[model samples]
Structures are given as structure tokens and as C-alpha cells.
Target chain A: MKHYQAWCFDLDGTVYRGETAIPEAVRLIGQLRDSGSRIFFITNNSALTPQMQAEKLMRMGIRAAPEEIMTSSIATAGYLAGQYGRMDVTMIGEEGLREALEEAGHRIVTEGGEAVVVGIDRQISYDKLAAACLAVSAGAPFIATNGDLAFPDERGLVPGNGAFAGLIGSVTGVQPVVIGKPESHMIAEIARKQGLRKDGMILVGDNYETDIKAGLRFGIDTLHVDTGVTRKEALAGHSEQPTYSLRSLSEWEI
Target chain B: MKHYQAWCFDLDGTVYRGETAIPEAVRLIGQLRDSGSRIFFITNNSALTPQMQAEKLMRMGIRAAPEEIMTSSIATAGYLAGQYGRMDVTMIGEEGLREALEEAGHRIVTEGGEAVVVGIDRQISYDKLAAACLAVSAGAPFIATNGDLAFPDERGLVPGNGAFAGLIGSVTGVQPVVIGKPESHMIAEIARKQGLRKDGMILVGDNYETDIKAGLRFGIDTLHVDTGVTRKEALAGHSEQPTYSLRSLSEWEI
Candidate 1:
């Protein structure tokens, strides 16, 4: 029932599932944009570039600029830049993560590095994992883009970036600093980058553990929708309730 | 010192470390073989084929037949064969694992398998991992050749089969049946294959955790040599001690 200056929407379940876009979410997002609210698309998918994400949104008739997208890869890069400035990094990820690191002025190396960053790499090889383990064991700062163990594909849930990071952590006896949902790094990065106040920003998502928890930890109001991972009935299981829970975004008042 | 009918020696730290052979271990193995004791070389390495391992031992002046080597890969194949009786399996591993599975009459499929097997694969790819995850999550039995998280190479400790299996397990939320040292499966398989009794068998190794624990759990006499992972001083840390502890194999009387 409350109007927010900034509206952060989760992809996948909130806006689209696979290739299909939710009409209710699309309508709500359009209404929010028309009402002069800043729109941000936040996702834990580190494999795709912001441009690629924006293109996906565009396909669903949702207009979003590449700059408006805050992927875990971008957040990881921003977080690393803020903490250690430019770093010599060793990475295990796709083009998106590599681009983000490069854009943040970090040099990517094969073996020894100042930081070891891992993301979802579909082309992941044993050599890449071995290099990451060696670097992390050598005391380099280990950073993971996200901690998602699995994500749904056409067939079923497949291994995510967290699994790869977990493997490296298990081998090296080192826990990586996760930079995705349920940690609030992405929300904080969005707030800091846009110079937005937490009180004026709200996160809308379908996942309770990731989206709602992220918003709560970042001190922002979270609106939970039932279009994705978590259902409305599942909300009763969590002690910490979201600011608002709706069956669909169509139920929300602009 | 009591003489055993069967002498099972762990490679790597026991017989050799890297490329060089441990002189005392080589002499002791020779003496044990000449005394008509059944000689077996047990290792958790699933990447190298039995023939390759035998060749490595031969290079160190220790003659070993391919059939005498009982690697985790062979044990895993044996375990699966006994449990499921030759299944269509999906796997993430290299030559050794493939050979064992094929030799055991199990068909290796890309997806939709009755079982899923994992091992240390230097050529590991994301597609292979994803397929394994899909199969395991779809209710296929998950098996790991070994649970050694990290193994020593020239550079340092790198990710092992356990790390890779851990990745898949984390994604699928399924624990794999490990067939390696410290689990006693390899020892059990060797016993079954050679028709040897536990009372007549003695396991010799440099690592207290893997070697000694395997022998102990398998109900056999264990001799721990202070040549590799667990030092003699560190043996006091474990509440369950090895049956015999020696500074080296040279300390043992024939």
C-alpha cells in the first residue's frame, strides 16, 4: 500500500520463468515506472552480462537499460573494487564475471592472484578449479559471486556457482565470501551505487530465503510474490515475515 | 612382530612420494613378497588406470601386476556391480574410472542412468557435472571413487575426487557412497577379490587417517609408518590408535 522511490525486482520467478514472462509482474513494473519510481533488476545469475539480461527483459516487453541491471557478477566486482581497489584476480566464471572484473580494473591471471573469485562457469574445467584451490590455499581472498547450489534448467535443477565454490572451499579448507542474495551485498551495492536511501527502496521477489532475507538484512522493505520459488503458504514457516506478501504483483496498488 | 599372510600397502606416502620411492618401504615390500605374503597396492587415486599405477611402481624398482593394484576406481566399480548388478551409469571422471566401469559391464551414459559415479577428473567439464547432478537428483544412486578432498601434486594440494563429488552432492543434496580409504570399501573389495580373511591381512601405510583407519574399520591389523601425512607425534591426537606404529618400515622385524 506504500509508495517507494526505488523498486528492485528479482528476475526468474518475479518477472519471468524460463522464457515466459509473468503478465502481472510486467504490468506492475510498468505502473511503477510510470509513477516515477527507479527500477532495478537484481539477479544472482552471474553467467549473463547486464546487456544480455536487459535483452532478455526486452524480449518480454519490459524496457530495462543495462545500467539498471545489478547481477551478482557486477556486485562482486563492485564489492571487490570498494574493498581492495584494483586487484590481480584469478577467476572461474563466464564472460560476464570476466567483463565485470576487467571493468573494475582488476587483472585476471592463471594461477597466483590477489583474490580468487568464482562464479557460474558452464565451461568449468578441473584446471580452473585446481588453480582456484591453489590460490585460495595460498591465502588469497576467496570471493564467490553467489551461493546458489542449484538452478532450474529445461530438464531440472543443475549445479550452480555455490557448488563449485563449495568444492574449492572443501579442498582448501577456506570459506569464500559470498556476494549474492541472502547476504545483502547486491542490495547494498545497488543502494551505494544509486545513492538511494534504504527507507525509500523496496525489493520485490518470489523467493523467501534469498529475496526477502536479503531485503530484511539490508534494512529495506521486501514484498514477496507467489510467482516463483516460495509460495504464500511457505511464508508461515519463516519467523521473520516480509513487509508485504501477495499472491501476485497484480494485487499491489500503485 | 607377527607375520601376516597378506600385506596391503598404500601407495603415495607409503611406497613412494611423487616420483621418488621410499627406500625402506621398497625393501620391506620385497621381503614381504619373497616370504610368500600376498602383496596388494591400495590407492585412492581414481585418475590413473591400474596398468599405469603398476608401471609407476615398476619404475620405482617395485614389480607389481595390474591385478595387484586395487584403486578406488576399481573398488567403486566392484561395489556398484555387487549392489546393482551392472547398471547404466553416468560418470564424471577419467580413464581409470571409465575403464573400471566398462570392465565391470556397466554402460556409461550421458544422462538418465541407474547410477552416477564420480572420481578425480582433470578434464572435468560443466556439462558432465550437470548431467551427473540431473541423474542423481532424478533418483539414481550416487557413488564416489574416493573422498580425498585434496591430493598433493608438484605445486601443492589440488582438488581431488571428493571435492568434485562434494560439488555434485551439494547441488543434488545427495550424499555419495564413497569407496576409498578411511571408508574401508577398497579394503573390503580387495579382501573379496583375493579371497583373503581379515585376520590374515595387514594394511601398511604412511597416513594414519586413511591407511590406518581403513585397516581398523575393515577389522584388520594396521601398521602406520611416519613417512607421509600423519607424523608419529600426531598419532596421539586420535583416540583410536593404529595396531602398530613405526618410524619407518625398517623398524619392523621379519
Candidate 2:
């Protein structure tokens, strides 16, 4: 791969598959870090905090700092802080989203908030959903961390944050502002935070629909790896092609 | 209304509105009962059992039997019984759904079920949704009691059974077989139970989307009253209008 100032990587399939690390990806990331290229781990997963994500990467033999991690939750937090300013928010998510919102100086209230933010919540309940609907209908801003309909786990693909968001949106007749992949919000926020332009940024991921589309939509170059959800053949249907399509991360050279 | 042997009425908007009985509806129902016309109360609400619905009607001064009540739960149970026979099923609903399934001789399993049934569940949880998604991804037949996206509550419109079902459907990439209004399944089942033809039945209600649409789709006559969701002006937008439009139930004569 040609040198880019910002090398944004997608987790799950791009850096690791489930609990195991992709050696080629880990090696490439290390090389990129050694060469002084700014690395950011971008993940749609809002279930884990940046610290947790960095720790996960570290366990896979890839040195990563919490500051270098850009989860959907973090992006959502940044987006809210930048766009809506400090606001009391009702949330439906896990520790990651809660921490990010609180860290960004937003109060997380149970009800009657200025905004309703939704992320992947394992302890999701009807009451939470009801509260969200009530808030949204009452004119509160509705925001979703990511729009990933499902995520693969040991039990196979389970309902993700987007599914719940969709449910709320359908019920309340209000569309949530999604701040994850396939939307330019995360990439734009990352670029804004780092003081870089789209020309110097390159997004690497296995999923063409989210990662590649995000990069393409953000006006940045994208590299597609076949180790995830989208295979080489599947890209044939899409009109827009990525900058590079590699069989593995090791196949690309700086 | 002209003499129709089978008088199917939608409960919420047609008969009563949030615990208070509509006086005209009560009077009309009483007259129908006195004239020996079979009265069937249909509801998209799967939260209550037929007994509960009947009791609620009885409290509203409208005598009703459990057998005369046709809830989405009952229709769902009948659909499953007729299609899949005795099979293990996963459920995301309340007491009504559980009772109907069990009474229909279907085993309700936590996981590894032959079907995944959804209904109006106030106590819905992530675990329930996750289990449903996993089972559906594993090729379980997905079924929803009704497709009412939202329903009016004390706090305004809240997420209904359809919203939850839509969430699971989005996650698992499976469409659920709805057994409520606008699909004609409940009406058809009711007609079958009464051994009556669609031509001989008339569905009366306030909502055009659910009640009138159900009758129209079932190839029966429909009576629209300006009592609920769809107003009279909104009916002008619909190409297929109800067989009768009344200002109130008192305006109709048997």
C-alpha cells in the first residue's frame, strides 16, 4: 500500500477474526507504527470502550493506545459534543457508550433528556425502548452509534445496535442520526480531530459496505481486504471500487 | 348497517378507547347481540388473553365470551397449529401469547425452536431478542402477532409488537409472517371458525389501516367510524373505501 499519513483500520475482520488476531494485519500495523504513520483503530462495535479495544489489540500482539482507538461510541460522543453542544441525554447502550458520553461531558439521564443516544446494549429492555420512543416523540434528538443490523458472535449473528435503533425509529417515526461506518460522520470527525485532509487518509477494512463505503463517502482512498464479510466477487456488483483490493494485508507493501 | 350475520369489531378504537367504552359502540353491540347476530371482537393487541378481553368488554357493559374474542395471539397460535402442527417454538411476548401457544399444544422452547413467534411484550429484553435472532438465523420460521408499529399509551404513541418484530427481522434478515390486521389472517381465521363466507362478514372499526384494510383485503364489507387513528379526511386519500362510513355507531341501523 502507498504511504498515507493516517492509516485507519477496521477491527473484527480486518485486524482480528473474533478472538484471534490476523498475523498479517498485526505485522502490517506494527510496520506502519514503526514507520511513523498515524494509526487509528476504527470499529463499528460500540460495546467496548477505547481502553477495552486497545487492550484487545494489545493482547493480539499489536501495540495500541486508547487514544488511537475510534469506536462508534467515541464518534457519537464527539459528534454530539460538536453539533449539539453539552446536552442531557437518555442512552440505551453498554459501558463503552455511557463512558464516552460522560467523558465528553454529557449527563446521562433516564428520561426527559435533550437527546436520546443508542448503541449496542446487551441489557436492552422494553422500558429503555419505551423511554427512547417517548423522548423522541417529545422532540428529543435521536442518535445511533452505528447502523450495523447484526454482528457475528459464538451464537452466530445477533441483533446489533442498529436493529434496536431501527425499532425505535419505526415506532417513533423519527430517523436517528447514525454516527458510524457507511456514514461520513466518523471519518470526518477523525480527520477534524487529527487536523488532516481526506487526501492524506486511507481506510483499510474487510467489509466493503461499511469501511469501504465510509472511506469513499468521506472522499478518502480505501483499501479492501478479503478477510471479512465482503468477498472479492461481491464487489463486482458495486459501481464504486476501492483504491486497492488485496487478498491479505501482507500482500500490500508500504 | 345492513344485516350481516357475522359482525367483527375492532376493540380499541371501535368498541372502547383506553378503558372507557364508546357509548354508541356499546349500544350497537347490544342491539346486535339482542338480534342474535354473532359478535366477534378482534384486536391487534396480543398482550391480553381472550378471557381478559372479554372481561374488559363485560366491564364496559358489553357482554362478551372468550370464544367471541379473536386476538392476534389466538390467531398466531392457530396459524402455527395449522401450518407447523406441534412443534417447539421460541417466543417474545406476554402471558396471552404463552397461553395461546400452550393451549394450542405447542411447546415453547428457549432455544433451538422450530419457529420464533413475536407479540406485544412490555417486559421485552435483549436476551429475548438475541435468542430470537439466533434461532431465526438458524432457520426457524419467524412469526409476528401483529404489525402495529406504534400504539397510543398514556405517554403518547409507544413502540408496539411490529417495532420489535421489525428489529429482529432486520437483524436476522428474515421477514415475519404477521397474523393481525391488514394481512387478513385473523379475519380469515375468524371466518373459518364461524363457518361463514367472506361475503357474509362485515368488519367495523375506526382505523382504516388496520380494521377497514383487514376487511377490504379479506374481500368483506367494512364500516368506518370517525372514532380513531384514521380520520374521515384521511379516508378520502384511500382508493378502496369502506363499505359504510358513519359519524357514530348510533347512525347505523340493523
- For model 1 the TM-score comes to 0.97
DockQ for every prediction shown: 0.90, 0.84
lDDT of 1 by residue, A63-138 (tens): 8999999999999999999998999999999988999999989999987988999999998888988889899989
lDDT of 2 by residue, B20-66 (tens): 89999999988988888889989888989999989988897878999
Off by over 4 Å in 2: A233-237, B197-199
Give candidate 1's fnat, 2 decimals: 0.89
Stretches > 4 Å off in candidate 1: none
Candidate closest to the true structure, highest TM-score? 1
Model 1 pairs in collision: none
lDDT of 1 at A16: 92
